[model samples]
Target: MTDAPFQFFDVEVLRTERLTPAVARVVLGGASVSRMASAGRDQRVKLFLPHPGQREPVLPDTERADWYDAYRELDPAVRGVMRTYTVRELRGEAGELVIDFALHGDEAPAGAAGATAHDTGADVHGDAGTASGPATRWARAAGPGDRISVLAPVQEENGGYDFRPPEGTDWVLLTGDESALPAVAGILESLPPGLPTRVWIEVHDPADRQDLPTKADAEIVWLVHGTSPTTTEAIRAAELPAGTPYAWTAGEAATVKALRRHLVGERGFDRRAVKFSGYWRRGASEDSPMSAADAEEEA
Candidate 1:
C-alpha cells in the first residue's frame, strides 16, 4: 500500500495550560484544524516537526485519500519516527484542541537524555542521546508556531470491545495504567447514571491521580509505581466486589495480558465479555507503538 500525498496545515498555539506538575495541556487553533475538533476523543494523529532551517515537510497531493494506510505502511527506516498521543479534548466552535503530556523525571530515559543535553549545552535535536529516546522529549518543549506535520486520525481497533454495562450487570471493573487513564476516564463518563463502576489505575505516584468527572456510580483506586512501571503488585491485590459482571483492563503489555487471562481463564468470566488492551509494552520504544495485532499474537 502506498501513502497519499501529505496535506499541510498550519496551526497556531492558542494557549498552553499546566494540568499538574507533570502534565501540560496545549491548545491549538487555525482554520486547518477545524476538521480535527470533530474527531473522536481517543483518535490519534501523527505530528511531524520541521527540522532546523527546513520548511514544513510536504506529502504528495495524490496520497491524501489513503494517507492513513500509506502513512502506516511507510518504511520505518526512511520516515521520521512518529509518536502516538491521545486527543484528550476537542472543541470545534472554539477552534481548540487539547493534548496532555506526562513530564519525564530523571529516571525516565527521555528526562535523562534532556539532562545530559543541558549539561553539554547541545541543541535539543542534535543531542543524539535524547533524540533517540522516547517521545516525551518532544512533548516537553512543544509550543505554538512549531509547524508540525499532522496525519489524519486513526481509530484504536480495540475501542469496539463492549464497555456498555449489560442490563443485569450491577458492577463494573476498570483497571489500567496511566497510559490507559484517558480511555478509562472516557468510559466512566459515558456510563449510564447510577451504574456502579470501580476503577483501578496504576500511576507513578499518588500525585498522578487526577479527578475524573463521571456521572456513573464509581469508586477509583490508584496504585503508585515509583521509579518504574512494573510495580503491578498493588494492582494485582485489588479484589473486585462480588458479582462483577463486566471488566475492562488496559495497561503495560505483560500486565494487561496476565490480568485478562486470570479474569477470563481462571476466574471463569466469559472470554467474550472482557475487554483488555496493552497500551504499551515494557521496554518498547514510542516510535513503534504496540498494536492490537501484537497483543493478540502475544496472548
Candidate 2:
C-alpha cells in the first residue's frame, strides 16, 4: 500500500442510529473501508456529502495533491459539501466505520426520503431547520445505501490523530462540547487503566449525555446548555488533580481559547502539555476562513 498520509474512499451508509437527543450515529461500510485505519483519539476525517439531488459527492481527482484546490475551483452548487468529523469507532473486520453527528437543534422532518426504510426515529428531539447545516440536514435525512466520500488515513501515525499524552504524565484533563464527545470517548476508552482522569462535556440537553465506557478512573461532568456553566467556567472553578498533567480541549473556538488560557495562565500548566483545537467557531460556517481560534490553537 502507498505510504500516503491520507487517501479518499467511497463509502455507503449501512445503517443509522440515534445515540442521544442531539447525536446521530451513522455506520458506513464498503470495500474501501477495510483499508482505512484510525489512530483512535481525536482522529480527524474529511467527509464529502452529495447535494440533495446528486447520487454521490462530486470530488476532484484523489491522486492529485492539489485536489482540494481543484474542488474549490468547481461551482459551489455543483460540488460536494465537505465537513470534518471524528470517527466514533472503526469496525475493521466488518468493513465499517461509525461517525456520530450532533444534530444541533433540528430533527429529520417526517416523510423525508428513505424515512420508511432506514429511519431509526432518532431525530425526534428538536424542531426541523433550527441550526441545521448541510451536514446536520444530511445526517437527519441520511439512510441506508446513501453514498458519500471520505479522506482518511490508512496508517495510524498520520497527523490526523492529535491527542497525545506524553510519558510520565500522571493524569489527564479533557474538556469539550458535544462536538468533541466522540474524541473524548475514544481517548477515555484508550487511556491506561486506572489512570486519573477528569472530563467536562457540554451538551444541548441532558439526553445528549452518553455512557462512555472506559477503564481509567475518570470523573465525568456533563454541563447542559442554559442549566450548567460554560465549559471554561466549569473547568476554571474546579480544583484539579495534583500531578503532572496533560490536557486536551476542543469545541467552540472562543471557549477553547478560554480553556487553554486558564490552563496555562491561571492553572500553571505547561503550554506544551495542553493540546487544544477549535472544532468550530460561533457565527461561522465550516467553509469559512480560519478564525483567531485556529491561529491561537496552532500557536
Candidate 3:
C-alpha cells in the first residue's frame, strides 16, 4: 500500500493533550504511520468514529473501488460516523500522528456565517466532546488507548491533500477560521523560513489560539470572537503584499466564497493563483450531507 492512493490503517490512541480551551490534541500510533514517507501539508484523512455505544467499530472492506458505496449500504445505526480531519502533525520517526480537534462543546460559540457555533465556542462542561457535533463530542471524550479507523492518503497521484501554492509566488496570504487551523499550521510548519506571509486566524476565544510554529516572515494576526470581525471580512479588507501574492483560504463555505470573490473579483487577483476550500458550510455539522464539489474556488 506504499503508493496506493487509498488505504485503511488501524490506529490506537497513544495519548492526548489539551492544546487550548476549545482544542485537544490526540496522538495515534501505528506501523503504517511510521512508514509513511511524506504527508503533504494539509493532508485530509477520513476518520471512522465509533457510534454512540459500540466500541471497536466494524471494519470495512477497503480493497474494492466501491468502498464508500459499500459503506453506505451498511445499517445506518451500526455504521459509524465518517468525518474528514486534517493531520496536524505526523512524526514518522515515532510512529505518531497528531490531530487537533476544534471542540464545539455546549458552550462553544456559534460558527461563522451562521455556522454551528454555540455560545462563543465555549462548552459548559469546560471540556471537549460536549458540542452538538458528533465528531467534536466524541473527540472531547476520546482518551488514550482507545481505537478508531483512519483512511489516509498514501502520497500517490492526485492525493487528498490540500496545500498547494503555485510555484514562483512572491508572498502568501493564509487565512481561515478554526476549522482550517490544523491545515494552516501544517502548511506554516512546512514553509521555508524566508518566505513572507500574512496570516489571519480567527477563533472564538484568545485561548483557542495555539502556538503556530513558522519561520516565514509572517505578520500574524489573531482575531478574537467578540472583538474581531469575521474571517472573510477581515481578510477581504487586508492589503495584499507587494509582488505576486498567492492566497490560501478556508473555513465556512459561504465565507470562503466571499473571500475568493473579494480576492479575484474585486482585488483582481489572478483566479488561478488563489486556492480555497470550504471546510464546512454555515449551519452544517461536520457530517452534513454536502456535495464535495460544492466548494468552488479559483482554478
Best by lDDT: 2
RMSD of each: 6.4, 5.9, 4.3
Better of 2 and 3 by TM-score: 2
**Candidate 2 residue lDDT tens string, 180-236:** 888999999999899999999987667678999999999999997667898888987
Q: Write the per-residue lDDT of candidate 3 for residues 1-299, one digit (tens) a residue.
A: 44476678888889888887667789988877865534657777777778767775665587777778888888866886677778887788899888887777564545421232332222111111323466666777788877788887665434677667788888988887777888889889888888999999878777677778888888889997668887667876777688888889877666778888888998888988888887765434433344344544311
Off by over 4 Å in 1: 1-12, 37-80, 105-134, 152-169, 226-239, 242-244, 286-292
Higher-TM-score candidate of 1 and 3:
3
In model 3, the runs with Cα more than 4 Å from the true position are 1-3, 107-131, 156-158, 285-288, 297-299
**Model 2 reaches what TM-score against the true structure?**
0.89
lDDT of 2: 0.77
- Better candidate number, 1 or 2, judged by TM-score: 2
* Candidate 1, lDDT over the whole model: 0.54
TM-score of each: 0.72, 0.89, 0.87
Instruction: After superposing candidate 2 on the true structure, give the runs of residues whose Cα lies further than 4 Å from its correct spot.
Output: 108-130, 291-299
lDDT of 2 at 71: 93
Clash count of each predicted structure = 7, 0, 19
